[model samples]
Target: MARNVNYGALICCLFVTSIFLGIFVLVPVLVALFAYPSSPSFSIDLFDNQALNMTRTDDSPTNLTIHFDLKLKNENKAIGLHYPDPQIITFSYFPNVSLLTILAEYKLDGFYQGNGKTRHVQGMVVATGFPTVLEGTDMIAFWVDLVGSYKYKKDRTKMHRVELGCLVGIDYISSKKMQSGFIGLVEPGLDSKLKKKPSPDYGYP
Candidate 1:
């Protein structure tokens, strides 16, 4: 009889141990598996120019800044800065937007130039106003500064459609704590180096 009682107790203990394990371990795993995947992205569009300035480049091109105020939509669902996904942000400008500057300068007149006339731009953006959750009806305001170098030449016309395109990495490092936006040019600027009777200082002979 004692042996029978001991066997029954062992069976009960084993069953209770399994139940506790399932509740503490397996259940949490299932929850995490279901909740780890999230969708985090937003849309953006160009608005009007805020401020822009132009100058003649010498041996070394000076860093000029062209400011613009942009409008974003559907920002209520924007994920944290650190999210793993490539977001597409583009900037479409009108004619005569040739002015360029650093995306963000730690010091005054500091910028980076890559390749011929391109620069690797990076900066932080903010969202303003109340956004309609899941409705894609959010309004975002932003100003972007394009930083690069340009050479000053005379009697030359620089006119064409400038398209600037970039991919924003929301979380390049943490995959949960960073966000980025890309910009592209839809219509470029058009200007010339004094076509008729070029200036003696800058006009080409």
Candidate 2:
């Protein structure tokens, strides 16, 4: 007597396995990439539109400490972001219209953002090391760009960026007197200080 091979049962089993894998593995990867991450509004405690606000400029100097508050929203409904410690946040400034110059930088620890949830990442970016000579240009326009990077898990592996980049535009009255006053304010170790600051524990509040 020969053994009976149930073709219908085997087909059903294979079909069920494929569906399970698609729902668990393949589908999630697609959703993660599709949903991605994004920052709707990036607010800092140092600007009024494009002008530097006077809230923390009591020292009458050109450079100031800006408290950055950025909202990171995970669009996926199934994935979470796994941010590591001391993620890099770079700041570049363009004093001249087209001459982009590297400026200061800082870093902050990462936080986990659940699916469809918004988390805040805060850091202090110092506006320093500006050249004293401004070529007597009044109302000089400045362009500042911020690049933030960290690891996020949308799938089995991690991802790098959520969107293109974060940018800020500044157009203010560049007074010679103001620049002259801040000539010697920032010492030689300003950059080191910005880089060596204690890492922030950006955990959930």
Candidate 3:
């Protein structure tokens, strides 16, 4: 009887151990799958008007506040964004005066501020490292000020089309997989268009 009892107990222990091992291995796969699982499509939304007041009267430094309603959903989960680092938000404007592509970058930290505000953030971007999660929902509102400028196409004299947009990445492979959302257009202005110049090969960064 004693020997039989020992054998039974051994079987029970093995069963339990197998179950535990299976769970442990499965957990990591589940977490990784959550990180960036496959899906039919993903999208982000931008509000109609600019949230914070943007002033570019002088070249000292200007803050361009942007308010956005961002949402992301996958096959099984919804994700929210929390940016601890500087995320790049790009604006492309073709002025009626310049024939060059005028690109502006706004770096920012974002949050969900109320009163139609996601959070009281400061910078030219809403947030970085977006879609930080796989199954959650968050309301994000932030601002971006024109802190500085970089010449993308140079020749700031010819007329061209100006469109506002952004550049985003996921899975650490930036530029390669970028999420760009079109915001608006820039009418005839100082930084009108791209000069007769050759633009960079790919729109990544």
Q: Which candidate number would show the highest TM-score if scored against the true structure?
A: 2
Q: How much does candidate 2 score in TM-score?
A: 0.47
Candidate 3 C-alpha RMSD relative to the actual structure = 17.7
Provide the lDDT at 152 for model 1.
18
Q: All candidates' lDDT scores?
A: 0.28, 0.46, 0.32
> How do the predictions measure up, each by TM-score?
0.22, 0.47, 0.27
Cα deviation of 126 in candidate 3 (Å)?
15
Root-mean-square deviation per candidate: 19.2, 12.3, 17.7
Full candidate order by lDDT, most accurate first: 2, 3, 1
Error of 1 at 152 (Å): 50
Q: After best superposition, candidate 1 residue 194: deviation in angstroms?
A: 33
Of the candidates numbered 1 and 3, which has the greater TM-score value? 3
Candidate 2 weakest ten by summed lDDT: 180-189
Model 3 misplacement above 4 A: 1-17, 20-24, 27-44, 47-85, 95-105, 110-205
